[model samples]
Target: MRNVRPWRLVAAWVIVILMATTVPFPSGLIETGPFPFDKVVHFGLYAVLGWTVHRAVRAGGGRRPLSILAAWAVGIAFGALDELHQHLVPGRDPSVADWAADAAGYTAAFLASSVLARKSSRKEQR
Candidate 1:
């Protein structure tokens, strides 16, 4: 395992925090659509979070399953907290659907990371 840069992990976490606090939509910036756009946004955001956490953990010398598990745990927990925070915002309300999307994103990322890690290990062994 390569050494994980602490700064990279810190930067990833900072991005997550900024994203959580930033308003979802500003007036007139973008009109709401009939489609479920917010769910897509939640999935994408949590996907990034999961990827970053996975990278951070792998850099710290964690094994494949452990790294993936940690990332998923962190991403899901953060998503829950983010939803809770939105409840306090005047224009926003928490939704379980959003959290489900977040979990799905994290799960997808974790599975992909695990597959890649296994492939890498196989190649290294050859």
Candidate 2:
């Protein structure tokens, strides 16, 4: 893992997301249930994507704020694109709710990472 590159992780994750979104679900595969499990899945996936993008940006010498912004921009833009791409897939319809979940998840992950990093830096200084 020591030699593993952060950008590689980001690219791999991006590919996974792209493949997942590109595939069309079978008809009747997804139903609007009492609870939306798919939103949770979208959130979790975007969270990981956000974290990876943030790490990659930082590893590439981006400053903290810049890294966070880059992660947010990439995550949200990708989410929007994913939603649009779904329109072309059979049995898939774009939803604003799903995009909202993606944005929320990305923001939560990046902010949490930033807070944790600041805390760890303070600890190291002490």
Output the number of the TM-score-best candidate. Answer: 2
Q: Write the per-residue lDDT of candidate 1 for residues 58-84, one digit (tens) a residue.
A: 667777566557666877887788878
C-alpha lDDT of candidate 2 relative to the true structure: 0.80
After superposing candidate 2 on the true structure, give the runs of residues whose Cα lies further than 4 Å from its correct spot: 1-4
Clashes of 1: 0
Give the clashing residue pairs of candidate 1, or none: none
Worst 10 residues of 1 by lDDT: 23-32
What is candidate 2's CA lDDT for residue 119? 85
Give Cα-based local distance difference scores for all models: 0.69, 0.80
Candidate 1: C-alpha lDDT? 0.69
Q: Which tens-of-lDDT digit does each residue in 1-126 have in candidate 2?
A: 333498899889889988988888875455468667888888998899888776666666665676568667878998999998999998788889889988888878877766776788799999
Worst 10 residues of 2 by lDDT: 26-35
**What's the TM for model 1?**
0.76
